[model samples]
Target chain A: MDLFGQYVVNGLMLGTVYALVAVGFTLFFGVLDVIKFSHGDVLMVGAFTGFTAASGAAALGFSHPLAQLAATVVFALAGTAALGAAIARWLILPLKSAPRLNILLATLMLGTALRESVRLFYPDGSNPKAFPALLPTSSWQWGQFTLRADSSILVVTGVLVIVGLHLLINRTRLGLAIRAVAQDEETARTMGINYTLIVLVTFALGSSIAAVAGVMNGLYYNEINFGMGLLLGLIGFSAAIIGGLGNLYGAILGGFLFAALQMIGAVAMPFASAYKDVFAFAVVIALMAWKPTGLIPERASDRV
Target chain B: MDAAIEISGLHAAYDKADVLIDVSLTVAPGTITCLLGSNGAGKTTLIRAILGLTPPRAGSVKVFGAEVTGEATHRVIARGVACIPEGRRMFPKLTVAENLRLGAYQEPSEAEIKRRLAEVYDTFPRLAERRNQLAGTMSGGEQAMVSIGRGLMGKPRLLIVDEPSLGLSPLYVKENFRIIEGIRARGITVFLVEQNVHQTLAIADAGYVLSGGRVVAGGTAAELKSNAEFHAAYFG
Candidate 1:
């Protein structure tokens, strides 16, 4: 496979991961107006859950690929959703009436606590543990191009998840309530929407989807660790801000654009690879400087 | 058979500052009761208290003979009261039709919803003309019409309108008042809050002048209009 074609493929796979991770960030923020800093930690927890489940099942003599993958993904998603619900109910709810800065700080503390707790509990605090390889570690070459099946699945599933979220936001009654609450909480409550329930549902649903991305990351990379979420969470957040926080499609586009820039930067100039974080942060800062509202900022509704 | 809305000694405050003090009023069924006041005379406060947006510190608010004090705004709405709140709060991102549909969120059947929607369109044909346009993109008067139409789609038994003529051209203001009268003509009781005293009194069955968060003067529209004190206080 040509290097250029490889970069494109790799970029796409990476973009899919970032997009999936960023989806929750945007969804949660748009609905509740607070960035959930612990979202990526929740994703890391999901990856660990999948890692243990798949490995334990394999050790118990279960060899069927489909069953193992399904079980791992479902368990991870359910576990992450439960955790998200608890956070939304207990930690987030009390601070709903508080200032925006307080919520942000609280989530930051929670994320740090979770990351540290995981490191302490795991036997090897700083070492990467082997994640069970659910997919065969083989690649298929198509004349000048190569694709890994797992990478393809990651991209496809991520795309499907985003499309499904779009449909949920635009077509369903729940979507209407969500959009209404995002626009005006007091008015939505006056319109008979249970704003608290909607917030909790959005948090749980977004986090569960993040869990899917988490499991995929573990499976593809074949390694997992406690702090895997911190860097990735920052990148995902940058993508979300670039895309315009409340807009779903914009976030997806931003993710892909981010990945493409990173890949092209790495290949075109070897020096850029070492400073990819610097480049990504620069891009985000540049975007904010140029268009402070975002690439697709929300329009003010007539309702206050 | 009963008063559409009844408030007695409605005392409310914002934080520690008293905004509404011993405010009391009632609107008869199928009639318009106009609350005429200047900007800070507590008209909006009274409306907000009635909708339970700001719970009254002391007193009672009864809508359709049911005490709705301390109820959430939407709950008050579900009990057959709707408010065209200050600023005509229409969902700007939605189409005029979508905004109307959301107004019928609590309606039981699609058919009933459709019927109500059609009635709204008939009443505000301008909204029908711009049904597919984004509500925010419309002119202010057009958006106000959509806002009022959306309120009507809820099939409200009593509608409390806060400053319906606000921010409108004089012609739109006249037309807007006519629309409120039209809603009243359909046998829906209206509790009208307005700064446009003369125009509101022209169509009102009865009127109250609010001062320092109290009903300083109230009577039949003509009686209030003819009274020297009211005329000097409001007009002079």
Candidate 2:
């Protein structure tokens, strides 16, 4: 029982990170019909930004763990938000009239460019860099069910952020504008909603969330690498697709589902635990083939 | 008379194909001006050009006497023009209230938005009852109400309604025209585009007929109603 509980906790923690990344994909897909293939690299950029911020803060004598964490998060989110908006405006918007495949390939190439730039520019970035331990190294035990203090903190923060996002999307005027634009771009424009501004804001918001996920990932794993975003991005995109592309709740659900599948695969086939992705992906393919719209298909009709 | 919207010598195209050529029209403040045409006569194109969705190749489009020929759609809307597009394009997945709230996207204050919401609700009690319902779930007549209510939420000085009667039953078509008349009664200038000639002319102050990308006829509604060419072009 305790072993099962431990796996569950681990899966949930990992799922939170996936959820954050998946939500970004869902949001981008909601506003723009295009999937941002470069999103995973954006998250990587965010992790690197946080890493640099943490190092700079430590060098400046802001040695307290909380202070370092705060600085890391703030700088990373802001930097990633700006980068996301720039990519959307300069990279995505200009290709509005181009063939859809062209945009997809362009974003794919942009992701490659970002990954290479980080690897080439940052000193020894191709090598994994040790992440700073900003989280408290403590654990709480309850009758063989142990929880690491840092993991607990991350879990609680992730839940709060997700809840906050739900409110921002459902209860705010900006959210209303976003939904309007998502539903019908031309009508939203005629209703006086600035299309460009909304698209930029959506990109910024999604990237900022990915930044938080990136920092949390580094803190949890204690290491960061330039190529880390590739697999993580693929996993996040897969999660979004399985959850139902463009559906916010579906993204989070898909994240947890993917994590659970991985955990189940690990426990059920201990000898081949490394092939968890293969198992999860096989199940996802079956699910997709069975119900292609996903678990919670988008409510909007496909008819134009 | 003050012009709410004025277009002169306008030329517009979609890609390489020209749709509007040397088109000139004026919508007087507080009057319903109808643009009548058959299918493929560039009526929708003309509306798109006026809203800045399609930029005119040559000519001036002035709203309240200010030149706004090539402004972005949202910017033009911010200058107090709202379009109830053809087919009553409501965000089907969104609630009736959400659709209405988006109409006031430029209104900065919550109080103003609330006031507009109340006003729209009062105007269309059917929409008020179904405010929380998804627009797609609503009946066609109800959807039209939500669309018109959304357009009213902007408190626009000039409301451009493109085919308000499309896909509606005869009773709903009458109701739609009545609502358009009410909008004109509220002192809002209306630019109506439609192929339903008789019903549109019944309520319009002035009318223009377009054919082959050109304004072939223009007169007061009564004059167009009496003219043999207009009658033959439309009814025959």
Candidate 3:
């Protein structure tokens, strides 16, 4: 029972990370009606940014764990958000009038380039780097299960970040503009909302949240790698699609659902725990076949 | 000092075929000038050209005396041009209030945006009651109120209403026309695009008849009512 409890906690914690990444995909899809395939790589870039910041802080002798966390978040958010805006302006918008497939191909290629660049440029980038222990590491014993405070802090941070994002999208002027652009771009333009400006801001906002997710991921795992974003990006994209690409709640659901599936795969078959990803993916494929539009489909419009 | 919207020798096309050919008209400031046309009469095409959605293949469009031909749609809109498009394109997922607030999107001041929203709600009291309701689920007449209220929120100098009467019941259509007449009464120029000649001409000061992608006739509403060509086209 203790072992079971530990697994549940681990699954929920991982779910938060996936949900964060998935929300970015949903936001990008919502505003522009295009899947930004480079979103995952953007997250990877954010993680690297955080890793670098945390390392610099350690070198500078800022030994406070909370301060280190803050440095990582602020830098990661700034770096990834700028990158996201640049990607939207230069890559996505330029190919917007091109065929839809062009966006997919362009973003996909951009992701590969980002991955390779990190591998080629960053100091010893091909190998994993140890992430700083920037949160309290105290643990509570529950017979066979051990619950760490760091994991709890990570989970709490993820929840707060999501809440902050929710308020930004729902309560703020920028959020209103984002929703208007997503719902009807042409009609939105009629309201004198600058389409390009909103698109840029949306990309930046989504990427910054992804930066938080990347930081959380590195902190949780205590490791970072240049290619870490690839699988995470695939999972995030899948989660977004499963939840309904443009739907916020749907992406969150897909994230948790994906994480749950992985946990279930691992727990259900102890002999082949390493192949749990295969199991989760198989189930995802089946789920797609069953509900192609997603578990919670986008709100339909039948305007005449 | 200048007309609200002036188009001279404007031509627009889709690929090889022309949609609006050599169209020209003037909307004097603070008056209701309507363009009446049937489904394929290029009325919407002219609206698109004026808004720069589909820029004219040839000729110039001046909004309040500024040349806006082929300019970006948002830039044109920012210059105080608001269009109530056909089909009542409400952001389906947003609430009535949210939809209305978007009308004042260009207004930077939160206080001003709130003021405009309150005024719009004043104009459409029913919208005020249903402020929390998603616009997509509202009744057709209610949706029309949202759309018009949205346009008015911008407090535009020139309001281009395209096919406001489309898909509305006679009672609703009459109500919409009444509201439009009220809009012009507020000293704002109105370019009403429509097919309901009788109702439109009732409120219009002057009008033009579009047919087969060209302006077949133009005159005072009374003149258009008595004109032989318009008579055969509509009265018949």
Tens digits of per-residue lDDT, candidate 3, B1-236, equal 99999999999899998888889999999999999988888998899899878888999999999999988888898888888999889998899988988888878888988888888878888999999999999999999999999999888999999999899999999999999999888999999999998899999999999887888889999999989998766555
Q: Write the per-residue lDDT of candidate 2 for residues A1-304, one digit (tens) a residue.
A: 7898889888998899999999999998888888898999999999999999999999999999889999999999999999999999999999977887888889889999999999999999889999998999999888989888899898888888888988888889888878888888888888888899999999999999998889889999999999888888888998999989989988999999998988988887765888888888889899899989889888663211
Tens-digit per-residue lDDT, A1-304, candidate 1: 4878877877887898888888788888877888899988999988888877787777788888766787788889888998898899999888988999999999999999989988998667567888877776578988877777777777788788888887888877788777777777766665666677888888898888888878878877888899998977877887888888877766777788788778766777568587776666776788889988678776553210
Error of 1 at A16 (Å): 1.8
Q: Higher-TM-score candidate among 1 and 3?
A: 3
lDDT of 1 at A24: 86
**Candidate 1 residue spans exceeding 4 A from truth:** A51-63, A121-129, A135-139, A272-274, A299-304, B226-236
Model 1 chain B: weakest 10-residue lDDT segment is: B227-236
lDDT of 2 by residue, B116-193 (tens): 999999988988899988899999999999989999989999999999999999999998999899999998999999
Error of 2 at A292 (Å): 1.9
Worst 10 residues of 1 chain A by lDDT: A295-304
Residues B109-136 of candidate 1 have per-residue lDDT tens digits of 8899889988988878888888988877
Clashing pairs in 1: none
Which should have the higher lDDT, number 1 or number 3?
Answer: 3
Query: Could you tell me the C-alpha RMSD of candidate 3 in Å?
Result: 2.6
TM-score, one value per model: 0.90, 0.97, 0.94
Clash pairs for candidate 2: none
Tens-digit lDDT track for model 3 on A1-304? 8889888889989899999999999998888888888888899999999989988888899888778888898899999999999999999998888988889989999999999999999999999999988888899997888899988888888888888888888889888989888888889888888889999999998999888888989988999898888899999999988887888888989999999999999988765788879988998899999999888888753110
